[model samples]
Target: MEVETINVQEAILLESTTLSSRQKNEMNVMKTKYGKTMENSDYLEKLEFFVIDVIKTKQMDTLLTLNRTDGNVPRWFVTGFIRMPGFLYAICQLPRRYRYTNCINLFIDSCEILGMICDDVAGSRLSKVDFNTQSDEHWTLFVQFIGVIYREGNSAGFKTKLIRTLRLINYREGEYTSFVQALFKAHSRIVVLRIDFEYQKGIARTVSLSEALDDLDHLVANMRNNAMFDHMLGYIFKVEYGVDRGIHIHSVLFFNGARRNGANHIGHAKQIGDYWQNKITLGRGTYWNVNAKIEQYRQKGICGIGPIHWQEYDLQVNLLNMVIHYVCKEQQMIRSDAEPYRKIIRKQHFPKINEVRRGRPRTIMIASVSDQLEVESI
Candidate 1:
């Protein structure tokens, strides 16, 4: 069966069409065979944007020209290429009736071409086989190429390693939850605010990466002195980079809920953002108040913002799983261990809780009599 080559928009529209009875039956059969359908819509959507960007910008040739000798390849390019196989597998798992055939074919073709380039660079016959027929061998070569790119220090290995560590923590279900739980233990309720700090348009290009990082550090240092954050309990910040935004920080601020009682989180976020723009960056920076889009997140059923009580288990889970992951997703992917990037920053010390006696204290005479009686029995 031949698959038609169509634009992403057209393919998406086709995918949305109501399925016929036969198509539905086939989809059911596929689901049963695959054990369970993989719900990777988010990943697939991002992959779609990547595909469109590569095709529209004609970056395929530059991506295919993998030079083993030249050490100038962009880290983003290598990481993005290495992620193609995973994307391909995601597409393949979709039922045939709803799959974007054109996108899958493009990935398959690119993988083959890039695999051949890897073979040439490695001076091996690893890429001589076809991925469609011999997927095991293809995957073996792909894993080998990962080591090749990691040694060159232009791959996603470091970021992947960090994410894996995070995943391990998340799996244990303690680290992030414990942090939040400790905050709640000290305070009756805590307000969570997410703020993104970025440079103004074209301003990032003017300043060097190190300068941008220094500015963030200074801003965070001054946050303690800022009147707005006087009641702040804790904070977490992650650094990331992009072509347009350059270097930026995604920060989550935890405030004493009692102190911020009846306060508008969105307005508070805006005030902090304005301070970052007007004071810290001196009019050269801007910010996004994530709390401003609270309604949208609520609509998406992933609402993890606003004030939360200690008993709000579901909201805490969302904050730990979704909010934290989103903040840490793109952090510190451009650098390596030699000049380590400060990917995440947090408070050095947490608030200590003083132990208080739960019941009335006994008099000194009574306490001494009880101790003497116990010693005599022994």
Candidate 2:
């Protein structure tokens, strides 16, 4: 069935006289599949030239044009002409920071168009090789890479290469290799913690989430300067449990003196239970439950400190998920060679992942249209 076109393509036609050879081929290919015609060759020619001009400008207009095509444009054509060109252009034209930022924008746009962008796509993008970085842009890349990967027909080997590159980028800083080192070096740590006392709980009906977060933030900041904390853990997080969740925290303690048999001791991680019980109550405010449940707890002493193992606890992982289990959060780094505590480093190569399908009828028409136009004029 014929679908209405978006006006952006019409704007392309109005601003130019004819389609480029490349656009003509694309148009023909699109037309043939639908058993339709780029019936208005004059308009098609103009639109083709317009697309070329936009692509040449490196303005990321391919996205605008592609989106404007409505349902008339098939996936194949969009992938090849629009997405590929825009992706490559952004990669080439933008600075490393801007390129990453724009890539994220494009991925987000695609997600909004496609519905429910998955984490796998973010993972795949993050795994892409860093063009010129000493260390992988792990966080930035992961945000976009996974979305690209989840899009149908992406190559696994390509993703693997990208991920491998990211690993190298992550290792650029030699001094701050482990969490222990990071704790010692404040500059290398990215996150801060906070703790605050509810000056007036039990008097107020409820405490705002913002207030709780502020309290946590205050606690995190105050704990950073603790002599024992600073001595053992440089950048380690100091958590304060509020009366909300039973007043305990899932915390990591840096035990610099902890001993390691084969390798150097990393540090001891622990959870202080019933954190609320230790808090100095404010005048009057109602605090929500923020305490996590504790089950089996064990500690194996390594150096001087212990790596305490608890059954499970919930911690915030990202901006989206408010509550995430400690197990899943920790396990995410299981395959990651970048973790501070990892000892066994194994490299496994997986097979290449993409498989292309035969061209559909619509594909031929678009290709034909794209070919007939003068690519330079467009």
Candidate 3:
């Protein structure tokens, strides 16, 4: 597939009316609040110092805290980074809650762009940074670092894109909810599975984003015809480009729960994952069995995988809110030069209306009492 690379700077300037008046007003309020507090010179100076310190000491966690409210960074500043070319990619590499040092290398690379750290120093700063310790000063400077990146990266353009991107995210979320509802209506129960298809670290660095996407598209097309997916009900796939992971896909597969007969959902997921790894991509790809980690999600109270009955309202809600929403979120953030409304999420195999049978038609019977009375009169 020929993938078009969007020029981030140019795309941000495109006009969009996706946000409602209320949303626009709210954004204006947020911008005004932050604008009054920090000047460009101060923001840049703080950012430079913060980057230099983090580079020298390798304190990456201080950078992570900028996303939190207690970190003292403005909300707009944090949100603005979402539109930065590779910011989301780096953020995705970080472990949840920033508990570990997964993306320190990427962080350093991003910092290098600011010209705050010398090229020679960046290579030596690859050691792990302790996420558990942070001083008050670090927090203050980290906020400045975040604010500077936004301000220097063209704050006005980022804000415009942020508004448009948020509106697109909301609209896509609604579509996801509706899609899930339709699946439930068509089938009494669905065996939901989540699988992540990604390239090996070395392979990821070797291929272009478009090439990766093409390989994934081919794999998915073949899977549809494969016997393993014979009873498939529906599926959704999302392509994301990350700094570390490169081009990858987050996918959800829906199958006929009755046919599965409450079988090992994780096992089924493994088969698909293995197919992507060994057969489809021919060892160039690796897959993560998201269902295998069900317990983790369960502990967090967001487990939405496994066989879910249509009548089970809570499970259905969880599936829609947690699973579906996740796959559909950040769709607007896809770095594509094609068009503003290009669809990054691919959905297919939905049950047709006529194919679905809902609780067999109710039987009706009428007594002929009037006929009996007429016979007696005769």
**Model 1: how far residue 145 lies from native, Å:** 8.9
Local distance difference test, candidate 1: 0.54
In terms of lDDT, which candidate is strongest?
A: 3
lDDT of 3 by residue, 1-378 (tens): 332233322332331245566544543443343232212222222333333333333333444544333333322333233222223222333222111111232244445554434322322222121111123443354455554543433346544644565565566666656667767767777899999898997766455545666777777679757887868878888876543465678899889898885468998899888988898788989988999998898888887889888777767778877888777665212344433233447777744623647575422121111211111100
List TM-score per model, in order.
0.52, 0.24, 0.57
Full-model lDDT for every candidate: 0.54, 0.28, 0.55
Q: What TM-score does candidate 1 get on C-alpha atoms? A: 0.52
Sliding window of 10 residues with minimal summed lDDT for model 1: 369-378
Candidate 1 residue 249 C-alpha distance from true site, Å: 0.6
Which tens-of-lDDT digit does each residue in 1-378 have in candidate 2? 432333434434442346577665644444233333232323322333333333233323333333343434322232233223223222221112111211233343343343333233222222122221111342233223333433421346534644553443233212112222223222211121221123342332144333444545544455545432443333222122222221222333333333212122221111111232243123232222221111111121111122211111111112002221121121101111233232211111111112232343111101111122221100
lDDT rank, highest first? 3, 1, 2
RMSD each, Å: 16.8, 24.4, 19.0
Regions more than 4 Å wrong, model 1: 1-174, 330-332, 336-338, 341-343, 347-350, 353-378
Q: How accurate is candidate 2 locally (lDDT)?
A: 0.28
